[model samples]
Target chain A: MQIPAPFEYVRASSVDNALALLDRHGPESRVVAGGHSLLPMMKLRLARPDWLIDINDLFELDYLLVDTVPNNGRVLRIGAMTRHTTLLESDDIKRLFPIVIDAERVIADPIVRNRGTIGGSLCQADPAEDLSTVCHVLEGVAVVRGPAGERMLSMAEFHRGPYETAVAQNELLIEVRVPIRDDSGSAYEKVERRIGDWAVAAAGASVTLAADGTISHVAVGLTAVGLDRNVTEVEAVLVGQAPTEQLFVEAGRLTSLACDPLADQRGPVDYKRHLADELTRRVLRAACRRAAASISDITI
Target chain B: MQISMTINGTFVTHEVEPRVLLVHFIRDDLRLTGTHWGCDTTNCGTCVVLMDGQPVKSCTVLAAMVDGHTITTVEGLANGATLDPVQQGFMEEHGLQCGFCTPGMMLTARALLDHNPHPEPLQIREAISGQICRCTGYATIVRSIQWAAEHPAGAAPETTTSESTEQEVHA
Candidate 1:
């Protein structure tokens, strides 16, 4: 298939040069990192741009650093341009957070993982994206850079709505800072028709408990199946209650009740709601299992 | 746009459209017709090539993106008279039937084997999933890779995947 339309290809050697090209070209330009998602869209005539400033030469952007915090806090300093493969295969990720890394492995096929950059995916802002929900519970911070220098937005504020974000057109997401939970258990589970398709519904469940398994704090966020992401109802039922199978069931029911599923070909509204509930319960149990285990013994 | 690269161990350059795909650059522009195109979409590896020794789906990349990179096609597998071990293995094992997908299959298999010589059956399957052969199930294809890895006649590059790999560097 031929690449759609005609556009000027500006190969950038540095980030400053890239910024200058975007400044000079104005809205006529779009940045290309890996070109996994954007080029396909262009070929199908979904997103057409007059100019493409290739940032392939900007090798400095790809970095994944783990940062240590005082007593109870831990952080993952992730470069936005790092490929999904790098994250999946990273020893640091396995050490800091295995649950989060396992969730990333089921993203797409290997080639897509090797080429699709983290920043590019987040910038696309698909509602059903898996990483966004992980960010929701992990309470991550997104570092963005642009013509206006650099700024950081919390995960909560960064994702505004479906296919929407607080990021400006001129800005590029530089890095994502993700928090690590020591006592808390975290798990992400997603459902799709087949591999390579976007998620129909994704849920990230995090729960911290007392020494006796009594729930301390809880966060459950669902994406794709819902318009606006709201987890207050589920968290309310989960925080005070002990993380047993029964409580997880209630949380899943509450979360599913909050979703307004649109009737579509994929599944009926009720069917999707049922799936939302089941997936929520399953993922919550998995997360709770991880959380109840000792921090040093966190596996899977 | 003008793009130049080594094709079949010879320096070749040609003017192409900015949107021209690398597979087309290899087949139509440079006339190294050994590289075949099956599925234009990247899901099929029939248009795969050794671009800088990586088995990339040439159909998915723009010729302009790899102007100065070293490239290799099926025609470059042999040295004058002797066929590379992989080529000999394919013929001996009946690794091809219609033969349309063999070139891309061999190139992809070669790229993988060059990186990890003793690949397990599962790994070989993953590498070749991009290439679809209507006939001659991947059993023989995997055997061909295994055979080549076991017996290398110094025809192929010794070890590649970066600065060290290009014994036939032409740009």
Candidate 2:
């Protein structure tokens, strides 16, 4: 097997050392986490780095912290290096973000999940990834560390375009923070061509039911349908109206309207837009059902 | 970069290019013909090897990244003349026809059995998900793993249990 490009290998024991290596190598070095995304790209000759700073050994970047919190407080802190399998098997993820867990369960099977890191997935910004769309719906923030310091960027602002991210060449994503919901309902659904292949379309919905059985807050993020995955403003339609199939159909239409899927070899633009509407409808219905189940009070 | 790693129970250090994948080092330089390469991508587990006793795709790994690590390839599975239990099980159960997927299947099975000695059918299926076998169907491959699970001592120290996992790496 011929590796695509020549690179200087440097295994850093800690985050600081990795940063130092990146600083020293600058644009020539590629920081490999799980290499689930990078290695494949390298093999295809898309990216050719002369230096690789292997940072997967940085154990500190693999912690999953979960706790009860007040409004605007930290609910969950997931280290970037945590694998998809960990997310699938995590109790905290199951209790807080069942959609994330559910989505992860179907992520490229068990072996890919075992090696695919959350940081790499997020950083890759694959439009079809369920977790990326899930993060967008949950208003997730990526905490990145670089030579200068660390900074947090929201998912919406972090992703610049297709297969692009705001992460600096020298920066390393250290953590991704997702707000935990005690009673809110969130769900993710993906349509795929194969068991281990990337998704054709994925949609995530997070809805908070009010005491009056109406929607308090609603966010919908749709992926694998646009130039870049995006979260549409579905709150206006969801706030007071009943989450009926008819309303979701309208929401799906509007969501599809918000998308700009370019025609690719896999599908035509019209077909992808149709998928956006259908997937949006399915995921919204699923989310509505889950949210309806979480309605504690019958005040309204 | 010059890399040093123990492959097949023997220690050998060699200077290699930085772009040389661990699979290339094992197959070309080290001359271990047993570790086959099907895809040269992580998707195919044909290049799978035990890096510090953990299953990893050698095709995606840089040889220098595994410096000083003890790697167990398919060639390392047998104890000299005696075949490993997993290998013998594959033969006895007729797990393979062309035998191209045998090495990858064995490594995948060995990794799974190491963690969960008694794996369910679903677990066995999941263990070999990384490997892509186009020959003889997966039924026999899965049965061979189950056979090994039943008869643990079909082959010597079995080669699977003698892994030198003194320390753990996150990768």
Candidate 3:
């Protein structure tokens, strides 16, 4: 029978109300979206906040839209409160970013997905979190709002460390923006012990091929292997190169060498490194194939 | 804090600590013990209840968060002197051996059937993947859900022991 320590609960009526409450409560306050991740941590005494501001009623923040910026580019904007079930069911997400659908299918069971939110997953910042890797590969931007107004931060800046994020105590993550690219496709591959278990090692790849079958841009990110972000060195190896088996093999080798995996019950450090390499190759192949298909779809 | 919500179609309110989980609030406060408490962590789906017609693990939800929401527990599954089709299906298919995991399983099946009138066996299995039945009677459970799907208009509330035994022998 686990129970969280006593706390005062307040329901925020709107985004403004939530930020004001956070400002009033100061650093001891925590905002709960789905409560799937936060409540469990509270029960274990790992996170003991004196005040819990429930933002479940902030329906204004629950949206999924694709907007075209004046010159920056077209971007997919997902509200922070959007649940996993919504993401898994969205045809737009499936067609535009199959990597999200692939990872959401195995993130947790359907029951958990019904309540878990995209923002909650990001803020938790668990080393094994799949969305982090997906966002890293896609170059996600987090829009945070506070008393001082809004500021956008890249995924690299948003993630501080394990269980830490750039969201200040007086701030709330309002939305996440991912730039949509043409002639690009993304895929995520993971190796877990069981059906709903966390990944032992997961890899995500996004590839954009030029008109002549050369790689214009490519990025690879890994999960549960202690890699903070995508492997820029591997991306450099693929950029401007032809999509060949030899290039993929070299990229895999470089990925395995660059990642820092720790040994635990899941597998040995060396085994995880090997998985990082293998999964990277697998996702890159899938992504490149999808990229080619997208190109053909456009021409047709 | 004082929280009020509709449970089993009845409006109920109680003063509960913010730390109290919806599972305990249902079982202890409301005395609706049908919603079992298992693996206090969200791993087990034994404490699942329908929140606004969607299945959610009650153990992970705080009582205060469910304020003004509609909650349907196992007690609300059937009308007076009648059983829900899922209940009848369970009895006919012998879906339970221990009965501890039955309430949550039935609620999950009910929600699934509400959305998808006729779900395939694979869909049914995927819907209940979060729940852990220590009895390991998933085969019968899946069959029971399938039976309910086949008889959407509702079936006889009860089946005699001899009839079930005969069906079991044939099975």
Q: Evaluated with TM-score, which candidate comes out highest?
A: 3
Tens digits of per-residue lDDT, candidate 3, A74-184, equal 999999999999999998898899999989988978989999999999999999999988988999899999999999999999998788899998999999998899899
Candidates 1 and 3 compared by DockQ, better number: 3
* Residue A230 displacement (Å), model 1: 6.0
Better of 1 and 2 by lDDT: 2
User: Which residue pairs show collisions in model 3?
Assistant: none
Q: What does candidate 2's lDDT look like per residue over B5-109, in tens digits?
A: 887678898999877778888888988888888777676777788877778888877787788889999987776675666887898799998888788789878
Error (Å) of candidate 3 at residue A64 is: 0.4
Ranking by DockQ: 3, 2, 1
Top DockQ hit: 3
Distance from true location, Cα of A122 in model 3, Å = 0.7
True contacts kept of 3: 0.89
Model 2, range A1-300, lDDT digits (tens) per residue? 446776667898999998888888888888888787898888878998888888878889998997544544866888999989789889988777878976886677666666789999988888777778888888888889987898888887888877889999888899888886645788887777766767777777887776666677788887777735444456688788766778888888988888877777667888878888888888777776777776655322
Q: By summed lDDT, which 10 consecutive residues of candidate 1 chain B come out lowest?
A: B162-171
Question: Whose lDDT is greatest here?
Answer: 3
Query: Which regions in candidate 2 have their CA more than 4 angstroms from the true location?
Result: A67-71, A227-229, A291-300, B79-83, B153-171
* TM-score-based ranking: 3, 2, 1
Model 3 regions more than 4 Å off: A297-300, B156-171
